[model samples]
Target: MLDAGADYLLAAKANQPGLMGEIERFFADAPANLTSTVTEVDKGHGRVEERRVTVSTQIDWLSGDRRFPGEYRFPSIATIVKVQAQVYEKSRQSSQVRFYISSRSMTALQFAEAIRGHWAIENSLHWVLDVTFNEDAARSRTGHGPANMAVVRHFAINMVRSHNDKRSIKLRRNKAGRNPQYMAEIIRA
Candidate 1:
């Protein structure tokens, strides 16, 4: 991404155990002077959630030649971020912590907003596909079948969303499924 003149924020998952361990250790012993933090609270869906974001720009070591043998070098990493979320539901409470590496130098609040925006897309689009189309339960797993079906589903979603009716997407989908003329109208729309 840095070579392409684009900045990125990527989650440090367990697949890269070396990188994850390095980041975890850095944060575990990080000094106050090297980090910035922001916290936000939200209440909805019968839950109260709190998110705490911490960021640090002291990442020169990650790209330097002093790294351990066989350790991957991250280039132009201007910031590292940690997000800890606490969710309080009706009968239980849970917490999770996630780490991310960013090529851009941004403040803690900016990282928080960016992370929230990313999840907003997941919730709005993926969640809708799972609920309204049962995409997760699909049986097309061979060859190009899954990709082809995904395109068809996206096209159908676009057509349904473009129709004039204010009905729910599930209702519109059912109407189109049963009514050829209504389907034609939706296609025309």
Candidate 2:
């Protein structure tokens, strides 16, 4: 996909033979010794997560990856990514050497936080869109209609998220929309 117009945060899995081989080659012949630290985390209700930090001291794993003449300059990078995945019937946590290739520098904490933040939104808003808002099951087939409605929904969601309250954004929006006084506070805030 990187070769295509879209940019990529490429992930390397052990199942991929060629890419895995390349990664192993880099790890084995890495200029500076590399070490990986793995962490396993468990949360209640069929939720398990594993995080890993692969700190390469000298070798630039991205060196062999395609780059414009002088686009990338870093010799090495400190990479960390957290995976909170579940396999049904039971839950277990294990860390594996799954690789992620991104055109950004990230710290270990950053990776774990990013992964967690991603799920927070997914569980909250995206699920709401699918279940509550039915964004996915929308039947709008008109030109620009879906896009327009999507924009309006996002605007509403953002406005609600900007408010301060124990109530959820959706609930806050509902209450504020029902009351002029509450609406005024939203505008002022």
- Give the root-mean-square deviation of each candidate in angstroms: 2.8, 7.3
Cα lDDT for residue 73, candidate 2: 35
Give per-candidate clash totals.
Answer: 0, 0
Q: List the residue pairs that clash in candidate 1.
A: none
Minimum summed lDDT over a 10-residue window in model 1 is located at 65-74
Write model 2 residue lDDT over 70-165, tens digit each, in one string.
343323333423232433336443434555544445554555555557658768877766654568888877999989988887776666668787
After TM-score superposition, the amount by which residue 151's alpha carbon in candidate 2 deviates from its true location, in angstroms, is 3.4
Regions of model 1 farther than 4 Å from truth = 1-6, 65-75, 142-144
lDDT of 1 by residue, 56-168 (tens): 99988677776466677677788989999999999999999999999999999999999999999878988878877999999999999999999999899988988999899
- The list of candidate 2 runs beyond 4 A from truth reads 1-32, 52-61, 64-98, 103-110, 140-149, 163-167, 172-189
Give each model a TM-score.
0.83, 0.51
Candidate 2, TM-score vs. the true structure? 0.51
lDDT of 1 at 161: 89
Deviation in Å, model 2, residue 22 alpha carbon: 5.2
